[model samples]
Target: MEFDMVAAALRQDAADVATYARVLTVTLADVLPPGSVTVEYERSLGDRLKGREGHPSRIVVRLGERTLSLTGGHRPVAEVHHEVRGVVLSRDQVSLDVWVQALARELVAQAEADARAAEALRRLVTGA
Candidate 1:
């Protein structure tokens, strides 16, 4: 998707307009190494807020934190270890820069790692 569209999504008001799931379901599956890095689950810190009562239990779209979960994908790489990877979205406390940066960084890193792993796996299989 275009960056403008993403920025627009961030501008939305989860408390009033965006859905509980919509805010948290902005997915970029292929951003990481081919199935190398995965979203295991998401945890919400929005509970500490007040007006968010009207929102769903998850009213944010924070990647790697709320909207996405990390599973055992990048681990197999054994060459690169990335922990901070996801967008950060909330009802009123949203950080588009942080989220975008995190996602981009992870996406690039994972893409690179996946490329490297592909060669590594190929070598292993071919015994070359």
Candidate 2:
């Protein structure tokens, strides 16, 4: 019964995260140029949520070829789980307004790096 109760709570959390993800996506959409970025939300479902198994619900932020996945599930404690490419960071909170600002900065940095690399390649190719 206790497990069931906790699972139910977690499921609710996942749904809440989904709602937050949608709104966050909208805000991100406004900041990122069309087609430059994408946000995805995943929901938890079915009968069981074993440990951290089911609360995988989260939002994915993709900027060009780089990606960041953020989640707030059990153990997140209003804080969030954040993953940048291969790096996983725990005890983070997506609830903070700073999260979005950080994301924007990182995305912009990635775009700038890509642009610089492309320009360098072009110059090399043209022998300029």
Candidate 3:
């Protein structure tokens, strides 16, 4: 079958981005086919306030046929590692510049895979 996959990231507050990343990861997995999407998150510590410190966060997403990953980090200092995956025709990404770049690359890879799948399907259908 021919498939099309698109991935994108939206700049938003650290907390909101984290929340949405997690929620979307689960939702996408449930809705999409098996093993098609991935989500990740990275969280870091923030500045010290009255001896209390905060953190910065980022998010990432991957949407494809065989692999999907998303990562996000949380606010003052940021550390990223968390990741998840699912299946769907939709897209996913991390709002951070670095993660977004990586996700973009993965999207291209997925597109290639989708194209190959399409070509194979066509060949099968035509018996050629």
Candidate with best lDDT = 2
Q: Sort by lDDT, best first: what order?
A: 2, 3, 1
C-alpha lDDT (0 to 100) for residue 21 of candidate 3: 53
Q: Write the per-residue lDDT of candidate 3 for residues 22-107, one digit (tens) a residue.
A: 43344223333344443333323433433432321333333433232333323322222334443344444333444434533444
Instruction: Give every collision pair in model 2.
Output: 80-92
lDDT of each: 0.33, 0.43, 0.37
Clashes of 2: 1
Considering summed lDDT, which 10 consecutive residues are worst modelled in model 1? Answer: 70-79
lDDT per residue (tens digit) for residues 70-96 in model 2: 555553323333446656554455543
Q: Runs in model 3 with CA error above 4 Å?
A: 1-33, 36-95, 115-128
TM-score of each: 0.27, 0.34, 0.30
CA-RMSD of model 2: 16.1
